[model samples]
Target chain A: MSQIIKQEKKRSFVTAPTAALLSLLLPGLGQILARRVQRGLLMFGALVSIVGLLVWRITLLGRLAEGFWPTLFKSLDRAPMFVAFGLLAIAGLWLWIVIDAAKQTNPNRQFGNSIFVLILVVFFTIGWQISEIDLVKLSSDANEAWVPLSKILWPWEAAVTHDTDTVEAGAKVLVDSEGQAPPVPEKTEGEPYLRVSPRKGELSKLDEDNQVIPGTKITVYGENFEPNTRTQIWWSDSIGNEFRPRYQGEYVSVMTDSEGSFEKELIMPYRLIPPSAKGQQIHKVMARQVSQVGPPLPSQPLILTIELIIETIFMGMMATIFGIIFSVPISFLAARNLMSTSWLTLTIYYLTRTVLNIVRAIEPLIWALIAVVWVGLGPFAGIVALTIHSIAALGKLYSEAIEGINPGPIEAIQATGANKLQTIMYAVVPQMIPPFVSFTIYRWDINVRMSTVIGMVGGGGIGFLLVQYIRLLEYKSAGIAVWFIALTVAILDYVSAEIRQKFV
Target chain B: MLEIKNLTKIYPDGTLALDDVSFTVEDGEFLVVIGLSGSGKSTLLRCINRLIDPTKGQIIMDGQDITAAEPSELRRIRRKIGMIFQHFNLVDRSSVMTNVLSGKLGYINPWASLLHKYPPGAKKEAMAALEKVGITDQATKRADELSGGQRQRVGIARALMQNPSMMLADEPVASLDPVLAHTILGYLEQLNSESHISVICSLHYLDLVQRYATKVIGLRDGQVVYRGDREDIRKMTDGQFKEIYGEEAVRVNAGEFDQGEK
Candidate 1:
C-alpha cells in the first residue's frame, strides 16, 4: 500500500508539468487532456466566434469603402448596430474563455489558456488599428457646413419699440451723443449731463407681414475724459415689462481715445426681448460714464444694466472658505471610533447624512435664491449655501474614513492609561490624514463646479454671466462661457488626480 | 509579586470559565501554568493582569487590591504590568521600532507620544530593550514582514519596553515549532533570572513546562487541580493525571513517554 501511494504521488508530479505544457500550445487543450471534452469544445467555439466577428466587421467596412463617400455615408447611419453586435460577440467570447480557464482541472490547461489569451490580445490590437475612424476631420466638416437659418433672422434688430418722434415714458431707448449737454459736476446731487435718444419709430413697428423688427443707434459725447479712461455702457427696457435685457456687446471698460470719444455697437435683446406693446409709445434712454480710477464723475444715472464680474469671483472664493471651515468639526462628531456609543454614532451619522442629502437634492441655484431672500443678494448668501452642503458631504466621507482605520493601534493606545481623546489623537488621527487630504482635494473640485451653478441665481460667479448671455439668445457668447467652465473642471480633475496618486 | 484569592469568572453565556482559582507568585519566580485546550489556563493568566475582569475574586498585586480598583487606578496598575498575546498583536503596518516605542506610551504624556517625541532617555531604553531581544538590526522593518519567531521576539521586546514589574505571556509559543519554542522559553528564563521580574506564562505542551518551569500550576475545568513545583508535578500518579485530563489524554502522554525511549 505504501509503495502504491508513493507511485501515485510521483505520477501526479510528472503528469502535472506535461499536461500544463500541452495546454500552453492551444486554448482548451488542457481541458481535453483532463477529459472535459464538452468544456473544451465550448472554448473552441468562443474563439472561433470572436475571430469571425472581427472578420465580418472588417469585410463589411471594406465593401463600403469600395464605393467611397456615397456608400460610406449611407452605411454610416447604421454603424451603431454593427458596433453593438461586435461588442456582444467580444463579451461572449471573453466570458467563455474565463469560464473554461476556471473549470479546467489540470494546471497545464490553465497555462495553455494564458498563452491563447495573449495571442488573442495581439490580434484584437491589430483589428482595432484596421477599424480606426477619422473622427476629427468628420466633426470639423459638419461644423463648417451646418449653419441654422435662424442666423439670417437677425433677431437683435426686433428687440425694442418706441413712439414716433416723441420720447414717451417707459419706451426702450439709447443714449444720444449729439446733445451738447453741460459737463456734470463731480459728486453732483441731482441729475448729471446725459444724452437720451428714442428707439427709432421706423424699426419699432412690424412690416405688413406682421413680423416685429426694431433698430436704434445712439452714441455718447463727453468732455474732459482722460485718454485711457474706462467706461461701461448698458440699457434697460420698460420696467415690469417682460423684455429681458440683452447681454450682447457688453464691455467691462471701453477706453476713450485722447479725444474722449467711445463708440460701441449694441445689439437689442434678441434672445429675451418681450413682445412689442400693442401701440407705439415713448421710451426713456439713459447713459452715464465713470472713470476707472477715483470716484465716478457725477454722470447721469445710466439706466444701462451693469453686470458685476468682480463680485462673481469674490462670491465663489468666500463660499469655498466657509464650506471647508464648517465641515471640520461636524466630521469629528461623525467618526465612529471617536464616538464609541453606537446610539450617538447612529444619530450623528443619520443627521449629517440627511442634511447632506437635502442640501445636494436642491440645486445650488435654488439654495442661492432662498439665501438671497434670507441674507439679501450678495456673496454672503452664496457662502451660506455652499457651507451647509459641504459639511454634510464632507462629514460623511471623513467619518467613514475614521471607521475604516486599523483598530490595532487604537486598542493599543486604549490599553495604555490614555483617555479617549488621547487615544483618538494618537491612533485615529494619524491614519485619517492621507484620506482626509484626498477628500479635501475632491471637495475643492466639486465646489468649483457648484460655484458656477449658484451664480445663475444672483449668487455671483461666471454662471451669472452665462445666464445673461443665454437669456439674450447670444449662443456664441454663451458657448464661450460654457467652454470656460468645462475647461476649469477638466483642469481641476487632472490636478486632483495627480494629488490623489501621491497619497496612494 | 502577584496573588489571587478564590477568583471566579462566569461568562455571560452561562459558561464558567474559571472557578475558585487561587495562586501566588513571588518576585523573580519563573512560573508556568499548564493545561489542555479549554482548561482555564488562559483565564487564570488574564485574571492576574485584570485584562479580563473576574466575576467573583480579588487580585492583590504588590499589596494593592487590583480587582476592586477604580477604572483610572486600574489603568495605572495595568501600566505597570505587561501582557503578551499568542498573536503578538503588533501593529502590522508599523515599523518594528514604532511597535516597541508604543510600549513606552504608558510612561510618556499622550500628546508627546502622538507626536513621536520620546525623551532621549526613553529612546536609549527602547534601544537597549531591542538589543536584549537581539533584533536591533530589524528596527525599521515592518512587523508583518518578520518570521513568526522573530515577531514573537519583538513582542517580548515591546513588553520589556514597559519596564513592568510583572510579565504575563499567554500561549507565547503555541504557534512556534518545538526548536523555536525552546529558544523563546530559554530567553524568557534568562530575562527572569537577570532582571528579577516575576514571570507567569501559560503553556499547552506538558513537556515544555516540565523542562523549563521552576514552578508548575495545573488547571482543569476552571479549577486549580494541581499547584506545586515541577518535581511534584512530574511525580503525579497516572490516576491523578487521568482525573484532570481524560483517560485518553493520559494514555496519549504515556504513549509519548514510550516513544521517547526510542
Candidate 2:
C-alpha cells in the first residue's frame, strides 16, 4: 500500500521545468499547479486586464484593429508606441512570474514583496516608454526657445523717439557762368531812350520769392535731387542750422520724382527758431533723400495688461461669494452626524456627498469650457465655473468642520426642551462660525488662483490676455501680465492670511 | 406624585432597557434608584418625562397620563419635569443665560421661540433660576467655560427655569470628581426639601444612596429586586446588596460586616 501511494504521488507531482512550461502556456498556470490558487487567479486577472487595457488604449487612438490578421500588422503601425511598450512590460512581468514559480511548488507566502521588483519594472518602463521621454528634445528645444524667452524675461524698451531733419540755406542772385548780375546786357542803344532791362521770362520760385509763415503751407520747388528717394523739406534758421517742420509727431517725408527732380507744397512747423536766431527768425528750405527709417513705439497693449489683471481679481472674488452662498446649507446635508438618525437621512447624506465628490473631481478649466458655452465667454463664465468648483471644495470643508464640532452642546440644548431649530441656532451655528470663516477666506484665496487657469481656457481674465499675448508673439506684454498676476496673488495671499488669522 | 405603572422600554436596537418595571415617588420625596450600569434606572426617569417613549406602560404625573401625551401636550408636560444629565448637557457654545433660558422653551410662544426672541419677563425668570443655583455671575459666560461643578449648577439652574414640580437627574454626579459629588447632590436635596419638588435621582455609591434617599429601589437586570426606606437601606445585608449589585461586588464602604463574612 505504501509503494502504491508513492507511485501515485510521483504521477501527480510537478517539476521546475514542467511548472515553467505550464506558465509559458498561461500566465498563472504554474502557480495553480503549485496549489497557490488565489495567487494564480489574481496574477491571471492582472495579466488579462493589463493586455485588455493596452488594446483599449490602442483602439481609442482610432487604430481599428479589424480582422485578426491584417489588423495585427497594420494596427501596430497605427497604434501609439505606448502599446508596444506595454506589451514589453507584460512580457517582462510574465517572465519574472514564470521563473519565480519554477523555483518552488509552494512560493513565498507574501505575494507583494516577492513580486514588487517586477511590478515596479513593468510600471516604470511603460511609463517611460509611453511618455516618449527624451532629454535630447528638451536640450534641442531649449536652444530654439532661448531667443524669445530671453527677450520676454528682459523687460521691453519703451523709449520715445525725438528725430528731426537738418537744413542749411544761402541766398543766391540770378547770374550766368560769369558770376555777375546782369549789367547793361549788350550795347543798350535802340532801347536806350525807352526800355527797362528785362529778364528772359520769369525766375522760378526756387529763388525764394515767397514769404512763409509758421502753421501755413508754402510752395517749394527744387530740381536735380536723388530719383525715387524719400526726401524731406527742412526749415533753415538764420544761424544756418536746418530742421524738419514737425507735421504731427515727426517729420513727414516726400518721394522724389523719377526724373531726379521734385516739387511739392510743404507745411511750416509751429516753431522754427534756432539757438542763435532766438530773437530774429529767418527760414530756408533744404531737401535730402532718406535711405532708412525707424518707427515709434505703440503703448496700447501695455495699458491692456493692467485692465485684465483687475478683471481676474474681481472674477475670483465673485466666484467665492457665490460659492459661499450655495455651499453653507448644502454642507449640513453632507454632514454625517446630523443625518445619522434615520435611514432616509443617511441616504440623503450619501447622495449629497457623492454629488459633491463628482463635482469636485471635474477640474475648473473643464467647468470653464461648459460655462463659456453657457455664458458666451467673459469673466462671467469664469466666475460661474470657479463658483461651481469652489462650492464642491468649500462644501466638503464645511461639512468636515460640522462633523468635527463637539456633540455635547447639541445634546445639552436638546435636553432643555428646545425644538430642533432652536437647538441648531443656539448650539450648532456657534461651533460652525469660526471654521466657516477660516475656510471661506481660504477658498477665496484658492478661487483667485483658479481664475488664472479659467482665463487660459477663454473665460476672460488676465489669463485670457496672457495667452493671447504669448500666441501673438508679444512676449513683452505677456511678461507684464505675468507680473500683474504674480503680484496680485501674492498680496491677496498675505491679506487673506491675516484675515484668516483673526477669525481662527 | 409620579407613578410608573408596568413601564417597559425597548430601544430601537431591541435592547430591553426597562422590562415591566414599576415604581412610585411621593411629592417632595428624594427617591434614589440604585442599580448596575444597564439596570433601567435612566429609562425609568426618562419615561416619566416621556423623553423616551415606553414600549408598553403608563407614566402618570399628578392626574395626567404622560405616555399618551400628544406632541404639543408632551411639551407642556415636559415643562413641569426638569431633566438633568450625567454630562451636564448645556449648550457649550451658548451663553449660560441662553442655556438656562432654553428650559423655558416649552412655556414660551412657538413663534417667539422660532424667532429666538424670548420675552423680557422670561429673561428675568432665568436670572432668578441662576441665582437659585448660585451661578448668576456665570449667566453671561459660555457654558463650557465653567468647571464640572459649576456646569452642573448651570444644568440645575436651567431645570429651575421651568419652575418644574419634579426633577429627574439621571446619574447627575457620575461624571464629577468623588469629592464634588455630594456638593452637586446637596443642591438637589435642597430643591427637594425646601422647594417641595420631587426628585428621582439615580446614584452609584451605596453610602451616597443611604445618605440622601428618603426611599430607595434596587434594580437588578431591569427588575426591582429590593425596596426599602432610608433607614432600611442604611443597614442593608450583603445578601440583599448582592441581589442587586451582583456577586463579587464588595461595597467600597462595606467595612466590617463584609470583612466578617469573607
lDDT of each: 0.64, 0.74
The DockQ-based CAPRI class assigned to model 1 is incorrect
For residues A8-96, could you state the per-residue lDDT of candidate 2 as single tens digits? 22221477788788888897788677665555676777777677766655555445556654555564676546657676778877887
lDDT of 1 by residue, A1-504 (tens): 243223322112224444455545555565565555555565666566666755565556546455555544444445654555555555655554545544454334323345356446645654664567556777877855343224322322222323322111122442222333333224323323334332342224355796655545444333334445555544444353343234343442356667654454434333233455433332333333542344333221111112333444345456656766777777777666667567768787667667766776776667788887988865677767776666667777877887788875665555545556666666667677778888877877777778767777876666776687668766545555565566677877899899988864
Given candidate 1, what's the lDDT at residue A126? 43
The prediction achieving the highest lDDT against the true structure is 2
Candidate 2 lDDT:
0.74
Model 1 chain A: lowest-lDDT 10 consecutive positions: A298-307
Please compute the TM-score of chain B alone for each predicted structure, in the order given.
0.91, 0.92
**What DockQ number belongs to candidate 2?**
0.37
Candidate 2: true contacts recovered, fraction: 0.49
Q: Per-residue alpha-carbon lDDT of model 1 for B1-262, expressed as tens digits?
A: 7888999999877989999988888998889887777989877877776667899988999899999998778778777777776777677656788878877777777677777888888877877888987889999998889999888888888888888788788888888766677667777877788888888998766666666677988788898877778687677666765666756665322112222211
Model 1 is docked with a DockQ of 0.21
